[model samples]
Target: MAYNCIVLVKQVPDTANISGKTMKDDGTVNRAALPAIFNPEDLNALEMALRVREQHGGQVTVLTMGPPRAAEVLREALYRGADRVILLSDRKFAGSDTLATSYALKCAVERTGDYDLVFCGRQAIDGDTAQVGPQVAEKLGLPQITYAESIQALQGSEIVVQRAFPLGKETVKCTVPCLLTVVSSANRPRPPSARRMIAYKLAATSLECPALLKQWPEFETAEALDRYLAERDQKIPVWTAADIGADEEKLGLPGSPTKVLKIDYVVLETSESRQVPATPEGASGLVRELIQDHIV
Candidate 1:
């Protein structure tokens, strides 16, 4: 049987490439110093969804909730064979913690509807809570399998997956209309297709289409440019909180209970370090010194 799948993806700060004034005294990340990239585990989730589509004959729809500039990841998804892409963007959705974020995502998923499966990364590096996917499942009233390493089998309405744990792994059976949180070990995500990359390099979301036309003027009207984009299947829909029917009270900062109390950086000083010989007397003396300094 053919199945429709939704893959939840995110564009996260490339922590590895972070540079220039990367930290503050309060311990908050300097987001401006980091370049954004597709979240690593989310790519695994996308790969899992695409693999399912290849096995069952279905389409993979990719969705992300972020600012309009996040369309960069959507275009990347298109290049990676996402049949449909949606961006949930709005200024009001800013400063959302996991609760608010999941609420918005649940609403967006409900708006899109008709999915046999939903896939998401186990956790986002920035948050590292691993809470969003399960929270979304609870909101949607669906069963969720987290830390899934692989989909073992699929039979009509039922599916089986292997969950990975720190020490070992276990298998699980669940019904469809369920969610799976993909782990990095799940599978290596495929690279974006070169042909699709070339074709969709200019793909634009609703917010970007008008500017593209204004900058190039090859298309006279928004309608004409939209038609042009539609013809090539390069138009990505951008939706606001209202578009997904999210309650204003339950979105953005208003819905978030968790607040960053402070950010701190711990610095170790090599100048404060002392070398001790690997001898009984040296170890005993070190311990004595530690005891004397009340550092034991």
Candidate 2:
């Protein structure tokens, strides 16, 4: 039996390079100040889905909700063996908290037809809430497994997975047509195929060239480019809230209850320093002091 899978991915600002300029006064990320890359754990999620497809004879579809330029990640997905890709983009999606974002994703997933599995990273690096996947599953009324470290087995409609925890790990068995929030430790993702990269280099979402042609004169007409891309079966489909039949009030900011009012950058500094002996007695004394001070 062949399984159908969807891998949810995100293109996130590289927080590792975060600086004072990373945030704006409006409590939003200054995306232009940071390089964007595929969310690390989402790659693991995709790799897991691909492995399932390889083992069971299935197709893998990768989907991401982001700006027009996010098509870069979609092309990257195609180069790495995804059977197809979708770009969920619109201005209304901007500034969405997890609730609204997941609602939109739920709508998109519903349109994708029935699937054996849906894979998402444990969290996006930007938000790190780890809520979107579960929220999407809730909206779809499907069972979900989060913090999935690895897949253990798959037989018929049931699948086993190793779930990671701080103490240790636990194994879980869930039926198919379920969702999983994948962790980076799940598997080492495969690199892009050079051949696929070369062949799919021209693949792009419909709005990509139009947005580019305005800024960079190197781009051709969106229509011509899309037509040319059609020949190679490489034109990516873009979806909007309306296209997916999402409720207007539940599509973006209005549907989101969580709002960031402000952002404060925290920095740690030593107010004072004290030397402690490396001996056991000295460590015991320090622990005693910490306990007395309630700083332990």
How far residue 86's Cα lies from its native spot in candidate 1, in Å, is 0.2
> What is the per-residue lDDT of model 2 for residues 157-273, given as tens digits with 9 covering 90 to 100?
999999997789989999988999998888999999999999887787778767646755554677776686687787899998888888878867888898779876554467898
Q: RMSD in angstroms, all models?
A: 4.7, 5.0
Model 2 backbone overlap count: 0
**Against the correct fold, how does model 2 do in TM-score?**
0.84
**CA lDDT, every model vs. true structure:** 0.90, 0.88
Residue-by-residue lDDT tens digits, candidate 1, 225-244: 88888887778998898899
lDDT assessment of candidate 2: 0.88
Stretches of model 1 off by over 4 angstroms after superposition: 18-30, 210-227, 265-271, 274-296
